[model samples]
Target: MTPVFQPGQTVVRREIMRGEPWIAMPQVCVQDDGDLLVTYTPGGTPMVYPETGAFPVGEHPWKLAGSTSWRGHGRLELHWTGVEHSIFLFWDGPQRAFQGWYFNLEDAPRRTPIGFDTLDHELDVWWAADAETYEFKDVVEFEETGPARYPGRMEQIRAEGDRIARLLDAGELWWDKAWADWAPDPSWQARTMPDGWATVPFEAR
Candidate 1:
């Protein structure tokens, strides 16, 4: 299949928070087999945090606090080789560099006019900075939310999570060591979303 996102293209990555959109610009890199690799630094924008019961009585769910800047760089590899799980690597700021990797087990992204879109499965794995140790995260939340939200696909999602966990435990997964040494091209300008970015709606899964 032909890749939907091209190398050097600027794409808006829209992450939904409490039903609202949080956006970021990530530079795209298309792989030889049509997978997509996106990289971005998470600073310069106010980070949003969900605050429970922080808003007025009528605005409970949407209440949020935007303050701290995310001090890190992130690389996400979106695979096209079936099963659609993506691996994320994060390098923290100057203080605590090389935080580690996160495996996001999710649905295959659907190509949209603005960009590609996928729903996160909640279940994930975290490989520590040491690179050998790892842990399963959000299993309770995944079990709680999967049935009610995803219905029939809960079992499949769990299986996918297990598969990734095994690969991580056995040290069979592929990760680029060079990414830890990567820096953005100095000549590339900072990216901003296109005019209609906010207008593109993600279909409810």
Candidate 2:
């Protein structure tokens, strides 16, 4: 598989929460085997906090929370194997180091002119750093929200989760230990989201 992005390429990754954009720069890496990897440090920017309620309202949409400046929280790494399946590794803030892999069962990312986009399936698997244990991370949450959100795809999504779970349990998964030791190049300047990034709506899987 040809890689879609070159290593060290800068790209904007935005997460839309309650119609607001939370953007970050994810550095790209192309593995020897042709899989693509992207990593970024999250929580550096001031995030939007809903003013009135947990859900968004027309009157008071959001307010900026955190420092006015960017602050680094933890590193987030994503390995995309054609988008049908992607593995995410997060920095466990409490543990103060790399946590473990999160298996996101979703549709393959569609390449856009600006960047890639994909909607996440509700189901996910969390593999502990020890690699000896794992658990279903969002089962109840998915059950509650998935039917309303995904409609007919819940069964397929759960099947994908089951397939990944089996692979993980059989020790057939891969984890890049080198990433734990990896850090971004100090020479790279801070990134901001380009204009019109939020205009494109990411389709649900």
Instruction: Please report the candidate that would top lDDT against the real structure.
Output: 1
Q: Which candidate is the best by TM-score?
A: 1
The 10-residue segment of model 1 with minimum total lDDT is 53-62
lDDT of 1 by residue, 85-178 (tens): 7777666666537667777877665545666556567788887778567788999988876675567888899888788778766878566656
lDDT of 2: 0.56
Q: If scored against the real structure, what TM-score would every candidate get?
A: 0.70, 0.68
Point out where model 2 deviates above 4 Å.
1-3, 14-35, 42-72, 92-96, 188-190, 200-205
Q: Write the per-residue lDDT of candidate 2 for residues 52-169, one digit (tens) a residue.
A: 3333322221233233333454445565656465776666455457677778765665454455555456588887677777888878978987775567878888888888878777
True lDDT of residue 166, candidate 1: 80
